[model samples]
Target: MPRLSLIASCLLGLLLAAAPASAREVSVPPWGSGESRGEDLSIWLVTFSPGDDVPSWWGHGSLVVEDRRLQQSRLYNYGMFSFSDAMLARFAMGRLEFWVGHSSVGSTFRFYREEDRDVRIQELNLTPEQRVTVAKRLADNVLPENREYLYHHYNDNCVTRLRDMIDVATGGQLREFDRAPGRMTLREHTRRYTAVNAPMSVLLDFMMNDEIDHPITKWEEAFLPDELESQVAALQVKGADGQLQSLAAKSWNFYESPTRKRPPAEPPPWGPWIFALGLALGGAAVGLAAWERQRGSRVARMLLGLENAVLGLVLGLPGTALFIMWWVTDHTVTYRNENLFLANPLTLLALPFGVALMWGSQKARARLFKVWVALVGLGVLGIVLKLLPPFDQDNWRLIALILPVSVGMAGAFGLDRVLARLRGGDRASTGRSAAATSLKAP
Candidate 1:
């Protein structure tokens, strides 16, 4: 999360500029000209699958074209972005600008291969004219005026760029013919890639709102590189014989990561459950102790204080962060988040109240008990919404981790209040009896 290094950014630009020297211009022949460019025109859908680096975590996509007539092989990449101060600031604000960039196919492949990333190459089925059209479009996209675009991760990223370019070249054949639905939603697809980085996956789920919940069609899910390649492989277009033909003639991996492993279909489902159960158990124990009036147990006091500090800080920090993201940042995906209710920064008020309740009088404890109950109610509402109709947010993991702590804190605080009230009632009754007996004797 540190500021982007200026020197590293400069070096990155230099590396990209120096990587490809054998690139050539693509010609745009007039449309409907039956002239065959007899050149060995090779068009490929290049997919650079995820690697260990944060930048490559979502993977990247590019179009590779080799025109033997010009002895040129170039990769048209739609994932390039400057790391300048202004660009980094915009990226952090979620208004990133990415650009189409061209480099030698050799250079592109070498970069991914050296990173130990998984790289797949699918030879595209294109007519000589279609091939020239794709090349020309790609070249035009890489031009200074046309290259830069507003980058939206799910809708207008590297993968979607390639999908769109192919769609345009084949008369929208890729999107039109690729209609099979996937078993997972866009959120699930994202989880598959980020699972290896648990913290990143959790942070992503926390920041992104319900915008990614609903199921997406295969064409829509092609925002991911793997999904895009798979969808395109089965895509069909009208052939010369008036029959449907596969868009990809053949597919093979250019570089397979030596350390690559199959990621889980989604983030581990059991993680939230385990975390919630721990909170529930702690709450039950504290409630039982309060019911028995175990004020003398130093261990209970210590545990209660520890719970308050941990839970209060845990809930408060992320809630504050999420709230800021919703209002302050340009990340549309982070806006209108429901997670705010569960972990409101206002819950941080509990930390101070918790200390006072442990050491202060019954009046102080009673006053703060309502706050605890309110926090618990918020968490319950979040959990309940997860089961209700039209609620599609995938936050079970979070609800599981947070709700139990809320429940435990509420129970402990409530039981303490009940015991305090009962003790006060008993003391008042004894005073009344003594006064009545003394008055009668006099």
Candidate 2:
């Protein structure tokens, strides 16, 4: 359950940025100031690598404006947000507000360095005029009224904001060149970063709908700081002399953390392993149920009841949350989720029936068997839906994990026997009921 809470808190963690409590406002020179001239100004993109905290897993980015004449540098970041109750409320509702803010470049580096996160910087190959333009925009972006923006995890965030700034300075050349297809979809990119925490990765995948499955261009992939860094480095933009040049004039790692390793290039292949685990659990449940049926032992019955109660919580709580995320919240990514079929909220009904079974109530066993059958049926329906084109969700991993469990549990609860009785009419049901009573007699 604590892991479940972590998943809830980190649902928007990929959109998070490095938020240092010591962040302070830094003054930026006016646009008309002599220091704003092209040659006197240089712009750099500062990228921080994934950190230990879930929020910092996707990394963070900020734009640094250096004024050689003034011997000063300011780091403008769009990731700033407070953890106040109001902000948390909005975050839960998917209306969180993030803002641009600036601090001394030295302090920004010091913060991430102490956190043991790697830092990289790339100097843009912008011409004199473009440098001034980008610097001026960075300055104006920090103005109180202009700073705030509604955060969208994929479409807009700290990294994408800096990416758009670069595109503007490049006169849209960055966007033009990055229109080529990306290496992976948005969901794959997310899985790449979140793979460090396996549970978080699976839960997030379950919560998100198929909207993230569409193919995206490299420009759209710039939503991640590392992707933006790589894309910008590979780009060619027009210089002051009207000649094409590399977009990244120079790039280097500013700091490398000794403690942290970089995120994996690809997501871990956990599907088969998860499926095996589900199969093993389901098999154990069937074995236990068979033994209970043969001996009518109190111990076996209690164990079966315990298994039902635990599974109910394991599946039901997240299923309930997913239901709300689809219908109640503004979190568009979680809408129309197909995982709802496998992890159905109706599984929660097993709790009371399980308790009744533990108390040796035959009626509870009959009702629980029907509930398990319904759950199995829903899981089968989900599989059937996947055969259609419109329901093109990449949920094979989830299906592999949940379907076997549902089917095995239903079988363990005597689904075949129940179905046979229903088809055999009242006469056969009377005989089956008498046989069931004789089997249960101690």
lDDT winner among the candidates?
2
For 1-442, candidate 2 gives per-residue lDDT tens digits of 3433443565756546645643576555644255556888889998899887778888889999898887777888898888665665576667888889888888788889989888899999988888889988888888888999998889889888999999999888988998899999999988989998887788778888898999999999899888998888889888878898999999988788887887788878888898997898788778778777667677988888888788787777777778876776688987888888888678877778878878888887788788888988888888898888888888888888877877777888884355446657877878999999999999
Task: Give me the displacement of residue 122 in model 2, in angstroms.
Answer: 0.4
Worst 10 residues of 1 by lDDT: 10-19
Poorly placed runs, candidate 2 (over 4 Å): 1-7, 26-35, 359-361, 415-442
Question: How much is the lDDT of residue 162 in candidate 2?
Answer: 94
Model 2 C-alpha RMSD vs. true structure (Å) is 5.0
lDDT of 1: 0.68
Q: Which candidate ranks first by TM-score, i.e. highest? A: 2
Q: What is the lDDT of candidate 2?
A: 0.81
Q: Worst ten-residue run, lDDT, model 2?
A: 1-10
Clashing pairs in 1: none
Taking all chains together, each candidate's TM-score versus the true structure is 0.79, 0.89
